[model samples]
Target: MASKCGLLLFVATIQVLIVAAAVFNGIRSGYTKVPTGQFNSNIDQILLGQNSIERILWDDFQKTPELTAFFVTENPVKTIANGAFQRTPKLERLGLRGCQLTGFPNLVYVHGSLIELHMSNNLITKFTREDVHGFTKLQMLDLSRNPIASFPDMRYILPSLKTFNMQGIGFNCCLPLYQLKHPVLVIDAAPCAYPDHITDRLCLLESRFRKFRWNHRLEIKAGYSSSLGGTACQEGIFGPTCSH
Candidate 1:
């Protein structure tokens, strides 16, 4: 009988998974929990870390133009209105780390598909050149551990910048950081820690706030708030309360 029908089809007697199939019915599909600190995702990235989100208006989120990364780290965010990602035309990474911003918000003159613009540990103090005249395709610009001392004209609006992290920004060691009498060397390498001791990784010049007596004109200066939407940190002192 053809070897007993090939041993009864390998003892199955008919040939198959012995008729006890269950390719994937092990069941465990019921997930829906993402509410603390906020979440509105399906992968296009929008972290919203530690949210108490002060402001980013424009209906917060859901204008996805295939949104491409937009975090609000350690949120207490002070401002960010003007088309807050304005239907994210493929926003290429834009985080506001440890918020309570003081300047340079309005999504950097209308996101030009930013390629990483962290705004490190907020409470920012400066940023000029018409506030980054449209970031001309920015490429990694993390104003490390803010309290910044105004910068812009990065070769005139980041003409495709390639990493400019002002580590713990503190340049005004007596206002010489800029005086343009033909003094062009603001970022041929962009790495700082000038006046007071600063740190946020390597540029650290030994500073535990160096014994807190540094008001060298507010080290990174930005008490200049005539309120055009910037500066905020008194009300239980928001996040990044002058970050370290």
Candidate 2:
């Protein structure tokens, strides 16, 4: 009788241990299957392409606080739904080049930590003053190869902007070149002249445009000038009308 009781007690203990092990394994599996919302809450940077991205289903990203950088480039078939990143708080750098975007997406409500923005090679035609008002900390902006015809009011630019690239675009007149404030390193104002205008007058002045070298100052080549007679002009014309 004593031996049977001892055997029964040992079996019960072993069964309890097995049950405990099974319960722990179940908990581990459940944790592993937690949704991405809880898993990616602390993600700082995300690079997503069209194949893996469904903008409509990703509307839950507004809750994430640590998200700082985002690179979004979608295919022609995939459209980025509006309001996709309206509420991301810590977002800083955004690159959306070659995304086939027609108009500017609404990003006015994002937090003010944004520093770098690259939106080159798009089809953007218009930009309001208020579209870029909230980006106080913006340092770099690339609007190359777009269809913007003119610059908005000077006050629309962020005060802390360091580098601004608007090359390969169209500008109506020389108004933007004269209005832009200091610290503008490059302006690519080559396209600011009309067909009939004096190319030298429209050319960016070498005095106004300076090139810096290490421990030395470099002389920038001035645009061409056209003389009344057949004699070669003072400086060659710099606009499209000038003969190469």
Highest-lDDT candidate = 2
TM-score for all predictions? 0.27, 0.58
- Badly placed stretches (over 4 Å) of model 2 are 1-39, 49-60, 77-82, 153-156, 174-176, 180-182, 193-244
Give each model's clash number.
1, 6
* Cα lDDT tens digits for candidate 2, 124-202: 8877666687788888877778888766644346787878777787555443222333344345544553433433232
**How many residue pairs in model 1 have overlapping backbones?**
1
Residue 209 lDDT, candidate 2, scale 0-100? 36
lDDT of 1 by residue, 152-197 (tens): 4365566777767666665543222212111222221223345555
The RMSD (Cα, Å) of candidate 2 is 14.2
Q: List the residue pairs that clash in candidate 2.
A: 224-235, 224-236, 224-237, 225-235, 225-236, 225-237
Tell me the alpha-carbon RMSD of every candidate: 19.9, 14.2
lDDT of 2 at 4: 100
Residue 19, candidate 1: C-alpha displacement in angstroms:
45
